[model samples]
Target: MPVTLRPLRVAAAQAESVAGDLDANVATAVHLVSAAADWGARVVVLPELFLTGYSPQAWLPELTTTPDDPRLEPLASAARERAVVVVAGAAVRRSGPDGSAQRFTLSLLVVDEAGEVTAPYDKQHLFDTERAFFAPGAQGASIVVDGWELGLGVCYDGCFPEHARAAAEDGARAYLCPSAYVAGSEHRRDLYYAARALDNGIYVVFAGLTGRCGGLDFSGGSAVYDPEGRALGRAGIISPAAVVADLDPVEVARVQAENPIARDRLGSLGGRSRVVVAGPRP
Candidate 1:
């Protein structure tokens, strides 16, 4: 590979969170951020709602936090020190219509290498049982990391082809999904992301949780798929692990050039209203 076109090293962290234990979860996330950074990952992705442990029964208005919350300072410190962007999930508090009240949305937090935290994607599709506890976001979001545009998605959001298609149409090279997939449903998790990647001819990453999370056993099948829908690395099931892969830009371009799906698609569709630039390209 030429120095001008270096591959991006990304990581998916699979870990167990203590239900409703925000402090412990934050600490664990900070540690994982460091681990990924030490392993030379320029971007680190964690499971959805890992900050709050993903328990609907324990849900409270107070569980929702803004990006400036002090509890997330440790994560910021780690990201800044390690110089790696951290993409994780949290229950974000948002103002309601006409300032009526605050609504909690399951959001994907883009913690940049500069320690800037932004909630660009709020998870438009709520999974089974999630509809009862969370509100769907308006649309999709994409972020630019080191010149490569990456689409953001939560667990259930990865199932929709339209969602990934829209992002790819809008110039996303990869989709980063933060999820908490339960046990026994491992097949769905396995199929959804791979299909999405191949369908769009883009990279797809699934970061999953492991062990017991909110009274459910989360299966850790975190993986990274190239444009050919091939797994780049092996991840453990029901074990805390970090799955890492080096994504080559040249390969993505080569595959997209050969694949005609993007050009064959009908009229352009709107996707990813928000565009976040992680930082300057190295």
Candidate 2:
């Protein structure tokens, strides 16, 4: 049998989020997922909050969906039929105290080729202004599809090293980020991704939303980075298109072995921990 994950075709769907239009958004997502599968992508990543767009605070209540809501079934169906893994975003509803529902800008799910939800990781870090309307999620997870273990992060979660580190430590060979990074935040799309890839010794795939949402201009620099901090390719700052790349696990391992920044440091941590705590604490 051929190596299913040795060279995986991955696509990043960089599309505009239709503000507060769940039906239209779902249609667009399904269309993109089909397009990705046609392009021979085994995995496809969508933008953060794509299902309901990056709606402002006022629209949060309208976009909430419980975990068992049927809205997610469509995406799962698409994944099963397409024989691809999808990581998409939504404004997910969570159980609050007293039976109230809490809303979050969550990366709602993971659907495999068998249409099963093998992993689900919500957005743990809410962006500025988002905290006013959304609650943070505590989910941390990774999914294995076709022998490739993938770590999923949504939007702001990409900025934190700990989130990426946790994912890397948990056996994620690739990190998939679905984002809605805005205009003034282009540096992270440019600089941070390379740094994270170098630091984690894994492939970093970022998919972002373009165009305006609630008056904020988005800069969609959807991209992929190799373990050596090389930019494979990227979408334009305002373009709505799909960016695809053939990922190789061998190349990922080769890059890390040659550089060995994160790997070396991680090895030393065990010994360093002994020295740091060698003395008694007061």
Per-candidate clashes come to 0, 0
Candidate-wise lDDT, in order: 0.87, 0.78
Candidate 2, lDDT over the whole model: 0.78
| Local accuracy of candidate 2 as per-residue lDDT tens digits, 65-163 | 554667667777899898998887777666568777555546556677877753377788888777876777777788776777888888778788878
| Candidate 1 segments whose C-alpha is farther than 4 A from its true place | 1-5, 96-100, 266-282
- The list of candidate 2 runs beyond 4 A from truth reads 1-5, 96-105, 117-119, 266-282
> Highest lDDT: which candidate?
1
Model 1, residue 95: distance off in Å is: 2.3
Which window of 10 residues has the lowest lDDT sum in candidate 1?
232-241
Score residue 127 of candidate 1 by CA lDDT. 80
For residues 68-109, write the lDDT of model 1, one tens digit per residue: 888889999899999999998888888868877988889988
